[model samples]
Target: MNVALYSTPRFGALKHTIQSEEQRNSSSGDDVAQPPSSPSNNSSHQHEDAQDLLSFGTHCDVKDCRQLDFLPFRCDSCTQTFCLDHRTYESHKCSAAPNQDIRIPECPKCQQKIQRPRGSDAAAQIQKHIASGCRDLVLLAPRRKCNHKGCKNTEALSFKCNRCEHQFCIKHMRVQDHTCSSQSIPPSGSDAHRLAKPGQSALKRAITAY
Candidate 1:
């Protein structure tokens, strides 16, 4: 009877060990950790970032302007990159090149702005502008009439005397015809011009002086 009791206890301990092993296996299967990523994949991601950095260019070479850029202005002479504002040789002060040749022809008639064709003559373009009536080429003549009373002749307006407010033709531009006031008349020893009667034409006095 004692040997039978010992056999029963040994069997119970063996069964308990098997059940504990099953429970541990089930818990491990429920929470299995994933394997670590490969080094090749990490390297590929790093390579992609490097490629993106290589695609974009560096900053502008202009003074005090260090902005990142791509497709920048590349000078043919100096082969140096520059911003749009400093693309020219003069703007950047390039040592490899001088000033560029770009001249816009202007109209000689009225000095109007015009767009000129490549390899075209500037003089011909000016003539074309004048013919198109874009500018006046003819010398305009004056249409002002004579200031003398009862005179019906037109002449170029030239006189700006203070005594006579009106413009006069060449024939009537004299002070006698317009009856210039004493204040407007310059200092002269001639009594005919200084002592002329008021409201009366100075023509009679002028004729006597002449």
Candidate 2:
């Protein structure tokens, strides 16, 4: 019988086969040891997370137009949240629009329109204007009547008489028309000119030139 020794060809062949199996096992173990890297799966998960975050926003309240708005506006009259297109009361046709933006206060003494700014108290603004001496009170004041005795005319503007220095209506504005108190007249032309009104001398000069 022939015995196969350690240095024979068959022993060498068996040792080579065992080494190949060990190398194959080591290669498979290395493949399983490292983690799987997929860039596409990571990017897809990130995109889904971003969409989930953006979904938390308000929706429009208009009928047939419920679009999502990240930043909504609130109407002042209706007090409802809306988008930019329907933020105004007229645009949305709000029911309470008529009662909202009219806050002008009238002056009790003058009956004139007082300008009241938005967000200001109406009563406080009126009180402040009254304390500041309302100009309409002086402008809308009653005109003084004629100073002539028993004269009932109060519609025309009063004029000052040059002779008596008394205010009268247009009918009695001339010195001769009313009671003349100054009977003495200027003797010289310079004296008459000095006594004449500022506009009377200019009017006379214009008339003479024309």
Candidate 3:
């Protein structure tokens, strides 16, 4: 019997078979790696989009709309938040409960529609109106000097002495401090208190409007 040599042609076929198997394995590994990477990246992006939508807060109550905000209009009748375009029940076609009345009343204090009260609050409304008027009064007051003779203090005229009938600064608010003329003072509870300073007739008119 003839013994086959280890480095013979038949043995070469064995080597070729092993090389082909390695090439096929490497090609299969590359294909698997590439497909998995693309799908994983796409899935991660989709997940990120979903998370963003959730963090963006509630959308408008109206169907087919997509306005989202942190301070959206909250409807008292329907108990839902909405955007500017659909903030009202009629505009959004909201399904409010029975006898649910909807109103987007302006705030009496701020005069802004954003801070609407849920129900009718007469006391709160009155207070808000009074406060708003007071703010306007403070803003529109004139700038003037202390009515005291020979004094050079000039600032926003805020107070008028009841005894002196002259506008003075906080530093000289007392009648005696400014040597005020008591004879020229108006009677208490008179409309002359509305006069801020001399030659300021506009202020009296403004106060009468209140």
Candidate 4:
């Protein structure tokens, strides 16, 4: 009778062990199924983030010019990434009257009249004019021109005079000789200047001057 009792206890233990093993397997399978769902959720979140990055009418940081476009372009002036349309619009229009759709025969930034592109539609020609003027402004953005007697060579235009829409190279800007009607020079200096210096002092000076 003792042996039979021992055998029955052993059988009960075996049955319990088997039941526990099955439970463990079931729980493991559920856990395995959950992992796939998490990946799908993560993928959906990533896709949404990507979409948000590409929405239309987003302004490109390029040049701080208000050109808006789908693709971001490196501004030749500011070297910041900006949408194309915003750059065109900002370069062409006065900052104070940005909404005013005056046909910019000249580059608002540089005050230079841009030549019309041949065989281009009116809108296209206008865009070209704006781009050309923006280029000139960017090129001259590094130094201040000596507003002083006959010193046409700008002093490395370190500062932009928002009131005058002119870039002062360095010397003339220090004297505060230049005046701008609009305070629209990006508070930041040109991209070329930043890359050339990359010094905190240089960047600080540019910001303070702007």
Candidate 5:
């Protein structure tokens, strides 16, 4: 009976020690299996969120075309934001297009076209064009006037005095009829040409009709 009691106590102590060992192993296994949250992954997620906020799309201001555009265009005339299709003044039917668009001023002297920018003086551009020696200006002033001192006559065709190299109308074409210099000066290189050109009358008639 004494040996049995000693052996039974030893067996109970051994069983308690085995149970404690199993409980510790199970708890350690659970700790090792679970993964810890990573700071770098959390930071990457936050960066993506910030980028989405920064790259937000803009809505087109046009009432009929309010499409969201990642890269919207702004109208210079109306000063309103719009999509690619409605960015131009004509496309949007802007009322202020005339004021902000480029201006083409017609030359008063030569009837030529010149481009003038928005909000700039068109007269200044025309003056610049004249200052640059407009080609049409020379063609427009093809008519020759009488060089007689007191006569204010200009004709579609004028006769040049071969003796004094002066231009005159048919009435004073003779050297004595108008006060010719009488010096028998050589005809000027400019006035040495024909008295009546073919297109002079037609050009003068067109100008008069206009």
Candidate 6:
């Protein structure tokens, strides 16, 4: 019988044997398990869900019409929304615009020129006249003077209404009818009076009255 000679395993052969043993051990149920998710796979799933969630009109209930890009301003008179093309047309005139020129006279809805009753125009004219007269009185009254000792200055003692001739000092001219019997007496001569100069007194009186 012939016998073979036995030899020690080389370093590489020992390493390979050790690796094989490790691989077998790792395959057993006692080995640490890896997480099922991968970063790439998770990102893809998240992206798909985001796309589903971002759909704009899915929540809208309109059966056929989509959301309008632009909305129209509704006319108060006609109770209708006017599109851009029809906004400037005479048939859809804006009632809010001041009709100072009276060019667009007719009501776009009823097709009637808004009329002021005959006396209404007269009443408005009278109001404007009264306002102008009041302004004139305010402006002119400052030029008149009272003959009283302390009131001798050139400034009007009060505004005397042209119609009423009611005299009110410059202080009372704002609201009180100047023609009323109440006489606003100036401060008499005293130390307190001296401390308050004519101009200062007038200003203080005006402020107080105001």
Task: Indicate which candidate wins on lDDT.
Answer: 5
Question: Could you list the CA RMSD of all candidates, in the order they appear?
Answer: 16.5, 15.5, 18.2, 26.0, 18.0, 20.1
Best by TM-score: 2
* Local distance difference test, candidate 2: 0.71
lDDT by residue (1-210, candidate 1, tens digit) is 887875897878998999999999998997887778999999999999988996787667877775566767787778888876666666677777734444766676576566654434345567777887965433345487766678788755556555757776676676765666536675445766656654255777777899
Worst 10 residues of 5 by lDDT: 134-143
Q: How would you encode candidate 3's per-residue C-alpha lDDT over 1-210 as one tens digit per residue?
A: 135676688888999999999999999888876444678888999999989877867787676887876568887777888887776555677667333444544445555443224443333444555676634222233479887787778886556888757888888786656767776643434445555455477778889998
lDDT of 4 at 75: 40
lDDT of each residue in 1-210, candidate 5, tens digit only: 887975797888988999999999999899888697799999999999978975788878889888888899776667888887777665677766666446567888778776665554566668777898764223233577899888888887899888788889988997767868886644544455554455788899999999
Where is model 4 more than 4 Å wrong at Cα? 8-35, 38-40, 56-210
Model 2: lDDT of residue 186 = 36
Which regions of candidate 2 fall more than 4 Å away from where they truly are?
1-7, 10-14, 30-47, 98-100, 103-193, 196-210
Ranking by lDDT: 5, 2, 1, 3, 4, 6
Please rank every candidate by TM-score, starting with the best.
2, 5, 1, 3, 4, 6
User: What value does the lDDT take at residue 24 in candidate 2?
Assistant: 100
TM-score attained by model 3: 0.27
Better of 3 and 4 by TM-score: 3
Residue runs of model 6 more than 4 Å from their true location after superposition: 1-23, 29-31, 48-170, 173-177, 181-210
Worst 10 residues of 1 by lDDT: 134-143
Give per-model TM-scores: 0.34, 0.38, 0.27, 0.22, 0.36, 0.20
Model 5 C-alpha lDDT versus the unseen true structure:
0.76
Decide which is better by lDDT, 2 or 3. 2
